[model samples]
Target: MANQTSSLRSRGMEMLIAYKNQPSVELRNRLVRLNAGLVRKIAHRVSHQCSEPYEDLEQIGYLGLIRAIERFNPVQGCAFSSFAVPYIRGEMLHFLRDRGTTVKIPRRWQDLQKEAQKCQGEMIRQLGRQPNDHEMAQALCVSVEEWREVKMANKNRMPLSLDATVCHQIDSSITLGDTLPDTYYQRMQLLEEDRQQLQRAMAQLEDKTRSAIEYVFFNGLSRKEVAERIGVSPMTVTRRIQRGIDQMVAFLQPQALQTEP
Candidate 1:
């Protein structure tokens, strides 16, 4: 496997050198094909931070990859992958920024989303139940496809604030920010990975230990209450909780990866 990777990297450099010396459409095409994975890797990473489709991002990324191929300085001794990444990511980001939103949602679609939401709220108040998609479309005098498109556009728009209070009157005092993991672009993927690891670690705990910890941490129960519920003494509950946490921490400890922007 190591030899295969080294051979591929060597071939890639040869292509880059050839392109640098005497650039041609054929050579550029070959180089692009050879380095397509780099663009795809960048596009996938970028997709985490934005609402754009992976396919669209990849298409946009090809333009950058071609640009990188045409302008590469092989004699400079910089790695092509490192040099190409910024171009690919920048192209996708510029494409996103040039449009007002993350995706190119039509203004009419945005307007329709707002109108449908308002109409639905009114109908729910009057009818005491939420309307179906067809009902909403009919009420707005648009086809179901149009209503669906409006909804998809809404989902693709720039994310709203986690600090915004919940829409429910009963829960208006709480912002989603208080309990949910951070969804900031840089931290979102890491936070999601951590959550998955946490779940697995929790699953590995013994049933009673898991129950005790969940009751105290998740259910906000007192240690004494947890002990009573689990038929154990308070000190035993403390020991179980600490041992459970230590085992989980051992399982979930991270091996950090160093990266650059």
Candidate 2:
């Protein structure tokens, strides 16, 4: 079996080399079709925290594969997979980092995040240790379910501003107001409304679309990662996400206009 596989690979290499010299639309299409499984395999391996679907990753990987095939030099005696892996992975990672960083977090959620951290510290100080969810809820004077919902709503909280002072530490003199005014309370209220509206809008999406958005944005998984987890084509994942976003934009536009007054 190993000998037969080696023989087949050798033939494939020869075919690849011949096609490389005479690269054409037909050749590129044929190569892509023949190496479709290879593209998918590379995508599965490279996708880490990316939110783009595996089909998208596969498409990117296929591009790498084409480059590899076109640039393959049998004279170098390098294995095709060895040369292609890094190229494929790099292409996918670049797309994820560039696109994923642009997602905007609501300002209200940012405030809630700061408050939650402060609340957690206060609870710890009073209890003399880190508190469990129940303990934290009790300390905050809220139900466990409400606390969980708050945590979920603020899961995408961004990093704290470096300019902001540390408010409290055992025996520390720093305070939050030493840097910025306490306007986070108002922001948190607005954020809560936005979160509720987003949740309602998400509920209206198709199941797959909703799930894809949740995993990609809420859980911080890449599209390729989500596609692999759900056992679907990455292209399907992309389509669902686009459709979902279009629906959300349409749904939110009227509300936004009403609020303009």
lDDT against the true structure, per candidate, is 0.85, 0.75
TM-score per candidate = 0.43, 0.39
lDDT of 2 by residue, 182-208 (tens): 588779989999998898889889888
Error of 1 at 115 (Å): 14
Note the residue pairs that clash in candidate 1: none
What lDDT does model 2 reach? 0.75
Candidate 2 — which pairs collide?
Answer: 50-222, 50-223, 51-222, 51-223, 52-223, 52-224, 55-234
Please give, for residues 1-261, the per-residue lDDT of candidate 1 as tens digits: 999999998999998888778778998998889899989998999887765679999999999998888888989999898999888888999987876554667757766777787888899998899888898999999999988878877786777688877645563577777668556864888888778878899999999999998999999999999988889899999999999999998876642232322
Candidate 2 Cα deviation (angstroms), residue 226: 67
